[model samples]
Target: MGMPASPAHDTVDPGEGLMKKQIRTTLILTLDDATMSSFVPLLQKGVQVKAQLGRSMKHLLCEQYGVNPEYLTERIQTIFLDGKVVDNVETTTVKGGAIIALSAAMPGLAGATLRTGGLLAAFRDGLTHEEDLEAVDSHELGMVTVKLFNLLVRELGPVLLEKGVWVTREDAESLVKRWADTPLRAIDHVEMDGLKVSLEELAGLDWSGDSEYLLLRAVG
Candidate 1:
């Protein structure tokens, strides 16, 4: 909000007067079993992934994101778009800045009610997502917030972490710091844009934005 109304801010830092402006940091980590287990928490907390908005959840996952239909039908048994429970993924469109939460079948009555097209779905009609006919129907690039729960976190989270997710540098730093206090596994390597970097460097890099989004990727 404080930058010039020009293209410079998008790709330049006049103050530093450098060709390579540090707008965002891309951090990649080589992790082992234990290190990855620790990463599951951040995945559950939610991370942003860039995708085509104004599309159905089914199209977003099955086509755009290339998720297997059978896996989508079986493993990912529950769906939530922007906090409301979803019954028909094919009709409920994901708007810009939408939050999508996925999970394996939850246990008990509440879980049964929340499952997509579950038999008890009618019980929660008040919470079910309904298409917004008023909203525009054009595809555009934007970020979607995704949260994984229970088995989904462990099962699906790694793919997302490896693919990379948008996160605030502060939050990413805090995650690294937390991992420091109670070490689960050794960090195999650290990188920024494919170049090796120290963990400290990754933490202190000038990742800039009002909210300051940085790409965090983990491979195990």
Candidate 2:
């Protein structure tokens, strides 16, 4: 008897692969009370803010963004600058294009060790971020990306979104596509370049892939 045919090789469908890739690039951010609960867990995207780079992180937060100094010290328990945990938020310089992620207290050993000035902070000394003292010319209008995780999302996300955040058109388009199908009754309307558009129209437009950025705000 002929040998049994070898098992078929697993192959990814082209259309399915494209769809998955698109999904990966898409981001959905929400500000509505009903959606905030669901969106908090899912909001891992960045918000861009124009800033004078080479300023201390604390200055950016407390002075520029109007984040209460006491709240920054007491409420925001964890800080990460470009992936590594940061301890001295006041001294750490925020450069243009840098990503700063903020979070409240987290559970477990890793969280404890990584938290700024936590009892276990010594454990993460090798992985912590250290700032350079050398000064650099600050840009008049430079973009810095900020990410809010966990409680930070609930606490700070709406304020920043309402104040307005800069996002690339490509990213905005991707966001529109991701939320197109969801029953987003919370979204008052969609705006592109200050013109109101329906969700379907927003998703259908071919975004200019240039350096133009959109001022995104979530209205109640």
Best by TM-score: 1
Error of 2 at 114 (Å): 0.8
Across 1-220, the per-residue lDDT of candidate 1 in tens digits comes to 0111111112222222222435356777777666677767778889999888788899888887667888889989999988888888888898888999999999999999999989998899588888898766578889999999998887777777766799877788787766655645477676565455545444444556555788887777
Per-prediction tally of clashes: 0, 0
Q: Write the per-residue lDDT of candidate 2 for residues 29-126, one digit (tens) a residue.
A: 33356644443533458778777798888888888877888999998889888888888877788887888889888899988898887888778857
Worst 10 residues of 2 by lDDT: 1-10
Q: What TM-score, to 2 decimals, does candidate 2 have?
A: 0.74
Mark the regions of model 1 whose C-alpha exceeds 4 Å error after superposition.
Answer: 1-23, 134-137, 181-185, 200-211
lDDT comparing candidate 2 with the true structure: 0.67
The TM-score obtained by model 1 is: 0.81
Supply candidate 1's per-residue lDDT for 169.
Answer: 74
Residue 36 miss distance in model 1 (angstroms): 1.2
